[model samples]
Structure formats: structure tokens, C-alpha cells
Target: MSEINPSQITFARVRRRLTKAQLAKELGVTSRSIQNYETGSSAPDSETLAKMAKLLNFPQQFFCIEESMPVIGEHAASFRSLSKMSDAMKNCALSAGAIAFHINDWIEERFNLPQADLPDLSDLPPEEAAATLRRMWGLGSAPIPNMIQLLESKGIRVFSLAEEAREVDAFCTWHGSKPFVFLNTMKSAERSRFDAAHELGHLVRDVYSMRHGETRGIEMEREADAFAGAFLMPSESVVANKPPAFTIKYLLKLKHYWGVSLAALAYRFNALGQVTEWGYRNLCIEIAKAGYRTNEPEPMEREVSQLLNKVLDALQAQKVGRAEIARGLCISVDEINALTFKLTRLSVVPADSSIDLVSRRSPGLRLV
Candidate 1:
């Protein structure tokens, strides 16, 4: 009904790392036209707008929003690293493990967030540890729907941290009592969801596992993963009567709700004593052969995180847009959009390495 904001479209496309030249060719426009649109001196016709939306895989309305925010949080430090790193490697690294983020000191710098003076979670048994966390956050017995939002709600400062550290296999690590969960942003919503839960394992279970700079151990990772499994799918609710035959269709149906890898679900079933070890192994081979692992998985956080929804809802309710929030913080709009709203409300170290200021509420707020 209204004209699109060309600048917003260009920003979103570039944030996705789609080049102007790439989109121009796909949309049958000259690169110079794309440039003009990005600078906001000119606009696209309806015909061009349809093509742009199709090529970018975005709704045309997405470009009509006045303010555009970076989907992931970015800092000057992160942007500098991105310029130096290969995108392909970044993709692989994020999809891989915890080893990737260390390439640019994201871990080191993120651990330095002002509120990260982690309380000691050591010497407590698993049950006691989880309970202490619940008590601290005032959580009920019900599972946390969104791991990222849940962590952010509790002031844990969850971030995607999928910067180009290509060598990493999918793993999470804690820095100075601050926990970071890196999900390969490129992975399907399914894989990303499980990765989020897996990282949640590291956060909730490993509060006390650190000593003298030791990283998360394999056994510790496993126990946290188990917690994530039970927490996410709720083994009691999902476990079938008469062991509803484990077929590919059955697994797909399970994945629809669980957002866990078939392999992980396969393992969970074995743990529940629903399937034999041999059946589990065979199922794994079958699922793998069927191209389940390589195919992108769904994201659980989109469905689960009440934290994220609440933040967006609260902001929408307040009519507090991203630009106003960023202007209030005197930081990039990208930071506010990338992380959950609670993280912003909490005092965080500002992105400016050049300026070190206290993290507190600003006295005056509202966009000019």
C-alpha cells in the first residue's frame, strides 16, 4: 500500500551478506540501480520489488519497515574479524563446535561483560545444581520453552556468537562464569534449536565445572545434553506405549515437535529403555543414510523462548522501536536487535572498545 524503504531492503540483504551485484543479476536490474536504491535517492518499482523480495526470500513488507536492525549482534571487533575471515569457513565453524569463536577473542571479550561476575556453582550435585538455578530464577517445574530467552531472562546474556570460526564443531563454552552458546546460524531451524538446547546444557549444568581454566569436559557436556534432552522433549510425555515402531516417518514426526536431531532422539529413546542399543545404532545409520543430519534442522528457539516473545511483545506494547532503543543506549541498533531485550535492560559492556562506561539505565529516553 505504501512505498518500500530501499535503504532497509539493502541493509537486510547486506546483513544476510547477499551482495548488490548478486541480487541485481537475480532480479534483472543493473548493479548501479541497486546502489541508487541503497542510498535512498531512488526507489524500486512494484515489478522490481516483487523480484527483490523473491530473490532475497523475504516478504515485500519486510522492506517497508522504516528501521532495519541487524538480525545478529555485531560489534566493531566482530565486523573487523568478519572482513578478515571467509564466510564459508564461518558457516562450517559455527555448525561445528566451540573452537571457532576463539579466533577473534569474542569469548575473551564477551566474558568481560560487566554483569558476568558468575556466582560459584561448584560442589553441588546435579539435582541440587539445577534446583539452585530454578530457585535463583524462580522457575517452575515446567521446561523452559526458549533456551536463549530463558538464559537471557535470567541475566545470562545469551548470544548467537556465530562469527567466522570455521573449525568449530557444535559446542558451547563459558567464559569467566558467563556462558556462550554458539549455533551455526546457517543451520536449519531444527539443528539450531537442538544446538541451543545443547548449549543450554552447558549453561545450567556446568556452573561449577570450571577450575583453573579447564574447559567443559566430555562427561560434563554429556550430562548437560541429557538435561537438555529431558528438559526439551520431556521423556515422560513423548515416550510411546508399545514402543510405536521406530521408522523414518516416526522419527520425522518426533522431530516435528522435539526439534532434536534424530540421532539425539534415537539416543534418548535408548536411555529410556524404549529401544535396544543395536536398534538405536541401526536407527542412527538409517537416519543418516536418509540424509537427516546433512539436511538443515528446524530451530527450537523460535517456538520455545518466552523470553524473546515477551521482549518483542513488551517493546511492541510500549511502541519502543529499535532506533529509539539504540539511540537511548547510544549504541548500534544492531546490538539491541541481535540480543534479547532483557540483555539490553541489563547493564552490558558497550561495544565501543574506545569508550568504557558504566552499564546503567540512561536518564532520558525516546527517539528525537
Candidate 2:
């Protein structure tokens, strides 16, 4: 067997959301030993390796495999709440992203997934960029019925954050040629849609610059928010449908049509100069009074990944189960679940089950 990379041990433990001391306690070792192991100053013996593998729910072979490409970086991820998040939380999210990169690679090798079709809009303004992407995707000014499905069809891989990291809103990163967006699904669907579009902005506009060390700033975040507004509710469509005067009731009604949060709609109206600053401030105050700041009214259904569902279904047809995939990746099934968006359904075929069972259980992909 190949020698283990110390970094792999750290990644495995961190991916499990374990502190060094916590993992050390579980492994019947001192925290210093765990630290040494992770820092390459010492190596664990066979017995220690076995304990680690069992404790971390990863195969010992996982530690021996060569390190994966460095997919996560400080500049790689465009965080929605970078200032509010802690280092541990950030590392946890980035580790999840690295796992996603591996999972995507595994899936791509077996399936004919959609190639990314986004155009370069780095130089354009956010609204123009959003408009251009919609035009390229042939979306026009129509409201997207399902933002997750739309992103999947366009070859943007989307994943849900682990429930533990509820502080993060959403983030996106580019891994090689693919764009990956991770959403915090605990939020309202409307908020998640906006987040999806916001991350989409980062992936399309800031990805290349991020690699060049132009890290995401306040300006970039504002640009992304603008993109999300224009993408979700086009100015032309808003102008055509909006009421003469912006009211909380009118904004609430419009939120349903645009599938955006009421607050986002109000902000968009203000940005478009349809509502005066005073009106916008009053609308915000009213929206807060109605408790739409944290929880909005008339929440839309949460969007899920269509591409992952199809891929998993296809694998099920071939007698490949989630457990098998997890084993192949040397990770736990729960870890796989964390890396996918609401991947709860597993098509299991018993030893005596007929081949017809596969066909009966698998649903056809819903291509938009």
C-alpha cells in the first residue's frame, strides 16, 4: 500500500466535522499525536490506521490514495456571508466543496451530463450580464419555474450545505472547467433562488478574476445581488407588471410571480428607480414589521437538483446503489447525502428481485 498523505487525514476528520482533540479522544490518542499525524511529522501504525478508518467512517485505503487536486482556495469560493462566517465553518464548507468536486468527477466519468453553456460576461454590468445569460439560455423575461433545475440543465452542479452549517447562505466555486454552487437549503425557497442566482453571478463573472487573486469584495457582492435581481425579475418584466406605486401588498403579490423574496423585490424596485428612496425605506420598514426579513410569506417549494437525481436513478438501474458509490469514494453514505441536494430516495434491488424492478422504480429525467 502507498504511504498516506498527512493532509488526507486532516481532510477526512474535518469533513466529518471533528476537531483534532475530538478525533484524538475517539482514536484513543493524544491531540498532539493527531496533530503530528496531520502535519506529516509522524505516521500512524496499522492498528492506529484501523481505528482512524473506523472512527472517521472512511476506508484505510482512502488515506493511502494520492491527494486530490487542490480545488478549494481562499479565492475559489464566493461566500454570501464571508464576514459573518468563522474559519472552521469556512473550512467545513470548502471541504464539502472538495468532496463535491470528487463526486462530480466520478459521475462525469459514467454519465453524459450537460456541458456548461454560460457565456463570458465579466466586463458587462450585472443587469446586462444577467440579461445576456437569459437571452443565451433563451429564458427571455419569463420567471424561472425552478432555478435548481434550470442550473442543472445548463451544467451548473448544485449541492446543499450540511445542516450543521446553517450560518452560510450560499457560495460558488469553479473546479477546473465546471461551476459548482452550494446552497443552504434551510432558508426559504425564495431566498434560496436568489442565492442560486447570486452564486451564478459569481461563477460567471468573478470566477476567472478570483483565480487571479481579485478576491470577492463588497462591490462583487453588490454586483451579484444585482445580477440575481435582474435574473429573477427582469427590469422590463417588472416595469410591465409592477403597480404604479410600490406597496407591501403589491410587492408580496409580485414575489409570488417572480419567485423572489419580498425584500429582494422591494430592493429591485428601488434600484430600478420605480420607487423613491423614501418609499423604499418605508417598504423595508413595513416588510420588517410583517416579519418578512427572516421569514417571508407564501414560501415557494424548495428547488432540488434534477441532474443528480437522474444520475443516481441511472446508477440504480445498473444495480449500483448509493452505498456502493460511497464505498467506492471511501466515504460514508451520510457524507454523500451531505454532498447532494435532498438525495433521500435510494432504489434498492434485492438479490431475488427481477430486472423489471429497476425499470419500474426509475423515473425518466425531466429535461427542461
Candidate 3:
């Protein structure tokens, strides 16, 4: 076991959104002492380490583990509603993602996860990029049956944001060679689908550009929104399916076929010139009046993570469960659930259940 690193204390405190003063109060220490510990001028005693671990809900061993991977930089992550989010909240979310990367590394060692198979279309226009990805993925003009599954199949790791901030719709970043897209699943399914596609746009276009020192501003956001609209409802399909006259009623009815929000469909129509400027203006007004802007009508079912479900199933077969995994990683089961899209089963097993026994004591455990 390694000695406890002072930096790990700072990382954990920051991840929990606790100020140094706040953590010091919780740990019954002076703020300056917390600072000293964080800055490596002092180290926590064993009793202090126990108190810190219990307070943070992290295993004591976690503080001793070397920090192998750094949290992704803010510039590298493409955040939706970036302006509305507090810096602390953003850090909390990103720290969660960093923990997820650690969990993913553990899983990858056990399971043969899919490899990323996406083209770099950083130079192409958003519309062309969407169309190109569609062709590349063999999606053509068909509506994606399951966006999460499609992404998982292509090896883009998708995680649900447990950050209680509603303003943060979604974000995407490329960690090492793999792409990670985090979605705010609290939104309606329609909006979540759009968010996934929008982040995909960032992953495909903005991530590479940002690495090359390209400045992403409002123009990038607009491009991502446009890409999402085009990707979810392809121009060819929209052209074929759109009515002669575009209206909120027509869009509401047509949205199910495209599996997008009515607002998204209307905006796509306006962009494609299928709806006149006057018609689009009235359509937007009508949509907002009907509360379609904030809430989607007839929302599709939420897309669950297919890859996570399979991984859990495989682990179950090997007599491994959430508690075991969490204990092994020196994290909480709640953290595991957050990283795995809340797919981890939480129900208590019967005392007499054989499955519980198997989970508690499994011999020769290996991933199939």
C-alpha cells in the first residue's frame, strides 16, 4: 500500500463540492491545516484519514492509491448550457467522469468492450458531417432505433449525469483515445436523444478542433445544434416525410416518426426552408405556448445503456455484484450506479438466497 497522498484529499474534497473551510469544519481541523494537507506541507494522521474517508464516503485505501489519470480539462469538455452551470458543479460532474474512467478501465480489463469506429470529420460542415456519419454507420435515412445503443456499439462510452443541476443538459469529451458522452437523463426522452446527438457533434467536430487550439464559441454551439437536428432527422428523410404545410400540429404528429422533439423538427423544417419564415415564427410561438419548448409531447422511452446492462449481466454470471465491485474499487455502490447509468441493481437479496452466497464467495471468478 502506498502512503496517503495529500493531493487525493484535495481531489476528493473538490469532487464533493466542499470548500477547504467546509471540509476543515467537517474534519474538525483548522482551514489552514486543510490547506497544509492539500499543499503537501502536512499529512493527515491515521485517525484523521479515517474521519476524512467516512466524511467523504470514500474508502481509506482510495487516498493511498496513486492518481493514475487526471480529470479532463474544462476546455476539452463540450458542455451544453455552459454559462448557466456553476464552476463547482462543472467540476463535480467532471470529477464523476474521471471516476467513471477508472471504473471503465477496470471493466475493460475484464470484458472485451467495443472499439471506437468513427471518422474524423472536423473540417466538414455540420450538415455534411452528420450525413457522413450516418452513411458511415449505415444509418442512411432511417431514424436511429436507439441512440445509446448505437453509440455504445461504435465504442463511444455513454454515462448518465447524476449532477442534480438541470441546466447542464449534457457534455462530451475525448479521454485518451476513447470518446465519452455524458447525458442528463432527467430530461424527456426526446430531449435526451437530441442531447446525445449534440454531444456526438462535439465529439466528432469540436474535440479535435479544440485540441488544435481552435476557439469554440456560440458558432460551435449553433453548429452542434444544427448537427443534432440533421443527424436525428436526416434531410432526405425529412424532405420525404414533411407535410406540404408545416405547423405545430403537423410537427407534433411527425415528431414520433423522427424520434425528436417537436421543436427540433420545426427548427429543422425552418432550416431546410420547408417552412416559411412567417410559418416558422408562428410555429415557434405555438410550440412555446403549448409548453413544448420545455416539455416534449408523447416522449419516447428513456434510452438505457445497453453496454452497461450486458456488463452487469456478465458480472452476475460470474457471481460478482455491485457491492463487490464497489469494494474492489474503494468506492461506493452509489458511485458505481452513477457510472453505469443506474443499471446496478439495488434490491436486497433474501437471507436464504443462493445467489447471495455465490456473490459473497465466488471461486475462480473470470469474465467470459
Count of steric clashes across candidates, in order: 17, 0, 0
lDDT of 3: 0.79
Candidate 3 structure, TM-score to reference: 0.90
| Model 3: per-residue Cα lDDT over 78-154, one tens digit each | 88777788988888888888888877877776777888877888889999999999998788898888888888888
Query: Cα lDDT of model 2 overall?
Result: 0.82
Give the higher-lDDT candidate: 1 or 3. 3
Task: Tell me the TM-score of each prediction against the true structure.
Answer: 0.49, 0.90, 0.90
Q: Which model scores highest in lDDT?
A: 2
Model 1 ranges off by over 4 Å: 1-144, 166-180, 240-243, 296-368
Q: Per-residue alpha-carbon lDDT of model 2 for 1-368, expressed as tens digits?
A: 57978888988887677999999999899999999999889999999999998888778888887865354877778899888888888888888888888887767666667778777789899999999999988998999999998888887888888766778898888887888889998889899999999989887788577666566689989999999999999999998887867887677788889999999998888889888899889889998998989987888777777788788778777677767776667666776777664633544543342233323443344466
Model 3 error, position 199 (Å) = 1.2
Kindly provide the TM-score of model 2 when superposed on the true structure, using C-alpha atoms: 0.90
lDDT of 1 by residue, 106-170 (tens): 22231232233234544554435555655565655444545555554444444443343323334
In order, the Cα lDDT scores of the candidates are: 0.51, 0.82, 0.79
Candidate 2 residue pairs in backbone clash: none
Give the clashing residue pairs of candidate 3, or none: none
Ranking by lDDT: 2, 3, 1
